[model samples]
Target: MELDYVVGQTLAWLRALGIEKDTFVFFTSDNGAARVSDVPVPGGGSNGPFLCGKETTFEGGMREPAVTWWPEHIPAGTVSQQLGTVMDLFSTSLSVAGFSVPDDRLIDGLDLSPVLHNNTLINRPIFYYRGNGIMAVRVGLYKAHYWTWSNSWEEFNQGINFCPGQEVAGVTTHTQQEHTMQPLIFHLGWGPWEKYPISAVTTEYQDALSRITAVVEKHKKGLVPGVPQLNMCDMTWLS
Candidate 1:
C-alpha cells in the first residue's frame, strides 16, 4: 500500500507538471521475496510457484515481474515474454533518450527498445550468477543448472526454509553441488515450478545441453574478472 501510494503520487506529480505522457516509468523488484518463515499463505511472504527465494539461483529467487509505463509510446495492455535482465535497463534508458551506449568497454546489456515498442520476442541466453560462479543459464524455455544450492543448513536448522515443502531430492540442496559434468536441465514450458528435470539420456536433453554448453564456453572465453567489492571495508575511520 505504501509503495502504491508513492507511485501514485509520482504519477500525479508528473501529470501536474504536464509531463505525464512524456515520462517513462519502469517498476520492478530486484529479486524474489526473502521468505523468512514457513508459515502458510497470508502469514509469511511468498515467491509464488517458483522454488526458494532471494539469495538462491532458483527461478523464485531470480525471476521478477517488470512493469513499464509510457502513455503514448508503449501500448496499453501489451505484454512481452522476452527474457530481460536489470542490466538491460541501462541500455533501454539510453535508447529511450535517443542516445547510443558507449562502445569503449564491455557492456553486457542489450537495448530492449524492440521488445518494449513492438512486443517483439528477442531470443537471448540469460546467465544466472551467484557471486563469481555461474550457477545456471537459460536459453529459451530450457534452463540448465550447473550448480544448485540454497540457504545454508545452518539457516535451515534455525527453521528458515526458503523452499519450504518444495525441495527436490537431488537438485536443491543446502551446500553447493556441481552438475557441470551433467547439468540438470528443465523444460520450463511444461513445468515453470521446476518440479521435473529432463532425463540426461533423452535426445532433448542432449540437444539443449549442446546449445547451452556452447553459449557458456563462449561467454567464459571473453570474460574479465572484476575486483571484489563485498570484502572491502574500512572500520579504522570509525575508530
Candidate 2:
C-alpha cells in the first residue's frame, strides 16, 4: 500500500510538471526477499517459487522482476525476457542522456535501450558473484552452479530458515561447495525452481557444459582481481 501510494504520488508529480514523457523510471530490487523467522509470518518473506532467498546464488536470491517506464518511448504493457542486471542502469542512463560510457575500463553492463524501446532480445550470459567469488552463471535458458552455499543453516542456528521446506539435496548446502569439475546444470525453462539437474551422462548436459565452460574460461582469462572489501573491519573501539 505504501509503495503503491509513493509510486502514484511520484507519477502524479511528473504529470503535473509535464515531464512524465521525458522521465524514465526503472524499478527493481537489489536482491531477493530476506526470509527470516522473527517476522509475524511463519516464513518471514516470500521469493515466490524460487528456492531460498537473499545471500545465496540460487534463483530466489538473485532473480528479480524489473519494470521500465518511459511514456511514448517504451511501449506499455510490454514484457521482455532479455537478461539484464542493475549494473545496466549505468549504461542505460548514460545512453538516455546522450553520453557515452567510459571506454578505458572494463564495463560489464550493456545498454538496455533496445530492449526497452523495441522489446528486442539480447543474448548475453550473467555471472553471479558472491563476495568476489563466482558462484554461478546463466546463459540463455540454462544455469550452471559452479559453487553452492546457503545461509539457511547459519540462520537456522539463529532461529531462522530462509529455505523453509524447499530445500533440495546436493544443491543447497551450509558450507560452500565447489562444483567446478562437474557443475550442476539446470534448464531454467523446464524448472525455474531448479529442482531437477541435468544428468552428467546425458547429451544435453554435455552440450550445456561445453558452452558454459567456454564462457567461464574466457571470463577468467580477462578477469582482474580487485581489493577485497567485505573483510575490512575497524578496531578503534578496542583501543
Candidate 3:
C-alpha cells in the first residue's frame, strides 16, 4: 500500500508541475507481475500465455509491460505494442534531450527516441541466458528458448533434466516448472512458450519448429565449452 500511495502522490505532483504534458512518464513491470503477489515457488499465477515467469528461461520471464504518458507530445490513451527494451531507456532519454549516443561507450541498448517521436518500433534481437545452460533468443515476435541447461563439461548430450514444477530460492511467488528443449521446440506455442494451449500445435507450427530449431542447432554445440559450474547451473538435472 505504501508504494501504491507513493505512486498516486507522484502522479499528483507531476500533474501540478505540468510536466505531465511535456514529459514522457513511463511505467512498466518486469518478469510479469507476480501471480501470488509475493511468495516463492511454482504455485504463483503465471503471466501465462507465455510460459514460466521470472527465473525459468521462458517467455513469461522475458516479455514485460510498457506504458507511457506525454500529454503534450504523445496522444492520450495510445497503446502501441511497439517492442522496446528497458536497457534502451538511458540512451533514449539522452537522444530525446538532443544528445548523442556515444559510440565510444558500449551501449547495450538502443535509442527509443524513434518509438516516442516517430512512433516507430524497435526491430532487433534480445537474448537472455538463464541459470544452467538454458537461454533464450528473442527476435521481434518470434522467441526461441534453448533448454540446454547442462550437468557436465564434455557431456552436454546428457543434458539437464526437465521438470515443470521445481522450487527456486530468493524470489518469492515464482515456482519451478518442467522445461525440455525438445518439447519446447516441437510445441513452443504451448508449455514453455505458452502462446498456445495444449493439443493445438498445427502443421504450420511443426514446420516453424523445424525452421527455428535448425538455426539453434547451428549456433549450439553438444558440449559445454566453458567452466562447468560458473558457466552452467544445477537444476536438479546435474550439479
Candidate 4:
C-alpha cells in the first residue's frame, strides 16, 4: 500500500531532515483504487469494493483515497472518511507549506489543511461527469444517477453492427430485450454495482425512440435535422 509505505518513509525522512517528529506528511491518490491493474494481483487490480474497471465514470472509478500524517503534531492512529478530490491536494499542500493561492489562478479544489491537522471533515458537494453527461451528483446522503439519454442505435457508434452485450469504448449498452430500454437510477450508498433498467422486471422500458423524439421536440432545430441519428450510444454499466 503506497499510503502505508509513505507513512513509514516520511517519518524516516523527517528525522533525516532534522524537521523533528512534529513535521507533517500528507498522503492521497488521484482517485479511488480504480487502477486498471496497478496492483500485482493475479487477475485485475484491487479496486475492491468498487465494480468493473476504470474509465467508466462510476463510484468505484472516481472516489479516491486521501490521508495525512504528522508524528507529534498530528493526531495519531485516527482515520476519517472525508470526501475530497485531487484538486484539494494542491491547496492543502500549499497551506501546509505556508503558501497562499495565487490571485490570478483559478482553483476548484478545497483546502483540506484543517482536516489534516484537526481531523475536521471537509466532505462537501461533489459531481461526476462523463462527456456532456452529468453522470451523478452528490448532495449529502442523496446520490442521484441521472440517465439523461436513452439507449439508441442498438449498435454502438460504429453504425455497422449493433451492441452485442460487450463493453464498447467504456459504456455498456446491451439488454435481453429486442428493442426498448429504460433509464436507471440507484442509491449510491448501496455500491451501485447492480444498476439495471428503471423497470428491469417489466416488459415495458423507456424507448430510445421516444427519448430522442422528446429531445427533438424540445430543441427542434438542433437534432441534426434531416440526418439519421441512429449512431447514438447510451451510457451504462453493461454493454
Best-fitting candidate, measured by TM-score?
1
Model 2 segments more than 4 A misplaced? 39-41, 152-154, 227-231, 234-239
Clashing pairs in 2: none
Clashing pairs in 1: none
Give the per-residue lDDT digits (tens) of candidate 2, residues 1-239.
99989988999999999999989999999888876556557786788898788777899989999988789988899988988899999998999878999999988788988888778888778999997789999999999998998864666688766677777888878778899999999999899998899999999999999998898899899898776655436555444
Give each model a TM-score.
0.93, 0.92, 0.61, 0.57
How high a TM-score does candidate 2 get? 0.92
lDDT of 1: 0.87
> lDDT at 206 for candidate 2?
99
Each candidate: what lDDT?
0.87, 0.86, 0.54, 0.51
Q: Show the lowest summed lDDT stretch of 10 residues, model 3.
A: 167-176
Give the candidates in order of TM-score, highest first: 1, 2, 3, 4
- Tell me the TM-score of model 4: 0.57
Instruction: Please identify which of the two predictions, 1 or 4, would achieve the higher lDDT against the true structure.
Output: 1
For model 1, state the Cα shift of residue 215 in Å.
Answer: 1.1
Q: What CA root-mean-square deviation does each model show from the true structure?
A: 2.3, 2.4, 9.3, 11.4
- Per-residue alpha-carbon lDDT of model 1 for 38-64, expressed as tens digits? 545422567788877777889988999
Query: What does candidate 3's lDDT look like per residue over 115-231, in tens digits?
Result: 776777776555566644545554445555444331222222343222133322211112333334443332442344443322326665466556655555654653335546543
TM-score of 1: 0.93
By summed lDDT, the worst window of 10 consecutive residues in model 2 runs over: 230-239
* CA lDDT for candidate 2: 0.86
